[model samples]
Target: MQFQIENIPIQEVKLDFAKDVRLFVKREDLIHPFVSGNKFRKLTYNLAEANKEKQDTLLTFGGAYSNHIAAVAAAGKLHGFKTIGIIRGEELVRKVDSNPTLCFAVENGMQLKFVTRENYRKKTSEEFLTQLTEEFGRFYTVPEGGTNDLAVKGCAEIITENEKDFDTICCAVGTGGTISGICNGAYSHQQILGFPALKGDFLQKEISQYTSKENWQLMNDYHFGGYGKVSEELVTFINQFKQQTGIPLDPIYTGKMLFGIIDLIKNGHFAKQNRILAIHTGGLQGIEGMNQKLQRKGQKTII
Candidate 1:
């Protein structure tokens, strides 16, 4: 299948925290109307590889509202592959389940299967694979958030095309694929900085195994909560950014990373003389109905 590439927008933001720090945001959120940004790179390249290898079905894992699953479902339907989303949690919903991101994924044609926390843990077990192979009839498995070699290769293409000399390339690290690719793709003179979306010491080893840039490092202080968790501060930052730049950032991913990078610059972690490039690995769909939810909690947006 021939996948379409999104031309995400790019803009430079000026910051008062440093003497000469200018941050450029590659607005990958604008990449696609439904599914966008890094998802394009993650899926496009892999699908091409699958086609080359003559694979018919694609299987992947994620939470109920995983951006990767949504993108894959959409991509698979457009291409000619069967896509299955092995959601992390059971299909249980608390009353106000307005997570537009997951809803969009269903609309795009994903077969959702809910599993218990313990069962989900066994998703990669030999027993699970054997059973799934019998059920799925041979499929290619993609890691959560599409963090794999092919996806990273696609990200590398993004850097080669940009050809900018920004001193630092900053992005939110969920699976570490995009940042790893940027580190691998960047010129030796630039630094590739990442803010973890999960709080744990393991992320260092996880990312280090994939990248070798001497200037690359992980910022551990930021993650509001582990994947899919949210907080008041994240909402505040998202609203503030949207008010100033008119971009919507879902609390689940990009918003948190962007908020942290700017804070780091303010705290003198980033050098004033260095230019920064921030990647917006779009997850806009997750923000659907976010305003109403926040309003119920009496949280007023910057807008």
Candidate 2:
């Protein structure tokens, strides 16, 4: 399966609180209808590898609203490959209404295999891998959030496409896929700071599982409330950012990463840095529910 890597332009803006901190966003959110951001970069090589091996099926893992799953499903279907989604959590297929992400996956011919939280843990185990291999027949496995060596290699290519000399590159760290790929490309010169969305003390180990970077960092302060959760401050800031810059940030991922970057600039994190390029790994639809929730509380959507 072949996928296109869209060259999203660099969007530069000045930081609100930090006078010296100049901010830029690589608008991966504008990459595609589905295969946006780091998702496209992460999947590019994997899709090529699958095509080289003549594999007909692409199998991957994610939650019901997983951006990774959304990307893989759309890419696979668009390129004439079968897609399988090993989704986390129990089967809510019949009980709960599917969200836009899940609906997109289904519309794109992605077969859903609902797994319990416990079994989902063993998804990468030898036993489960064997089962999927047997069932899918020489299927290509893309890990959750598309974080693998192949994905990282493809992500590294992003650096060459853009001609900028930022001292720091910041992006939300989810499964470390995008950040790892970025670090692989950016670690030699630029400082790579990953604002993680996952909780638990094991996040650093988890991040290192994907990339090898000496100058990389993971911020522990800005998770807000783990993956898929947000605070009122974040919701407010997201609203303000859109109003000021006309950019919509989903709270689960990019929104919080931006919040951390702003806080860092305010706290003197970018004092001596020349520039910071923040990767906008798109998750716009994820904010639909948040928009509704905030609207119920009388908060308006700026975008």
Candidate 3:
């Protein structure tokens, strides 16, 4: 029952920016083909805890194209546990074929349960969970976006002693677990900058509950519009980036994060001679779903 995930390598990207600045990407995406990047880190302990409790089922929440759902489903399949994904937007129930992530989850044997947006909100409520347990028979519940104490514990390992030379560590923030763990594990002298793919000042509060470190700051400007919202400019950047680096970035997280990092570097946001490391928290599984939307809109798709 080894999960088969491994430590990723750090790749230095030769960007056309200030020569004194060095940019590197910790390729967390290479950890696994399916349960890659931050998802792998976030689920490590949570899955182990479920096994310790003798729970056979893992229940979690996500949207139509949620990386969390896809990762959880894959992990369950790999580790021999039943998985249930409570997806937002009930309309997606009939459109699984059109959605790549959902389809993949179903293919991996994750039981899909579609809920209305209204009911999905109650997923965090005790009453709602009570009803779920009654129907599912004492399942292990993982919070939506998979940000919980165990998730934070797992993410803290993302930073290693070898990477301490970096002056600034950057990552894409989703539910905040990844960055929160990094914030806790990072050196006090290094600053942690999170480029959130979703729009909101609310993540600061959510992240604060996990770690007491003040070394992190969330950049609110990079989220194209909101969660799952992308622009032509972003698509173009993602395509060109892959061409330049041979690294594929997902529109939801890593792509937006790299865009913001390069922009900040070009604008002299970071002082000269700074060492920066960006975490490639993978969400590549959602590219097909995004491309489908782009095709329908007749816009450029991510390459």
Clashes per model (N, Cα, C within 3 A): 0, 0, 0
Estimate the Cα RMSD of every predicted model relative to the unseen true structure.
2.7, 2.6, 1.3
261 Cα displacement, candidate 2 (Å) = 0.6
lDDT by residue (129-184, candidate 3, tens digit) is 99888888878888888899999999999998878899999999999999999999
Which pairs in model 2 have colliding backbones?
A: none
The 10 consecutive residues of candidate 3 with the worst lDDT sum are 1-10
Q: Point out the higher-scoring one by TM-score: 1 or 3.
A: 3
Query: Which candidate tops TM-score?
Result: 3
Error of 2 at 245 (Å): 0.5
Winning candidate number (lDDT): 3
The superposed Cα distance between candidate 2 and the true structure at residue 52, in angstroms, equals: 1.1
Tell how far residue 111 is off in model 3, in angstroms.
0.6
| Tens digits of lDDT, candidate 2, 150-188 | 988877777764734788889898877777777778746
Candidate 1 lDDT at 51 equals: 91
Instruction: State the lDDT at 91 in candidate 2.
Output: 69
What does candidate 1's lDDT look like per residue over 10-90, in tens digits?
687766556767888888767676557788877768999889889988888887557788788888888878888887767
lDDT of each: 0.76, 0.80, 0.92
TM-score of each: 0.89, 0.90, 0.97
Which stretches of candidate 2 lie above 4 Å from their native place? 1-7, 161-163, 289-303
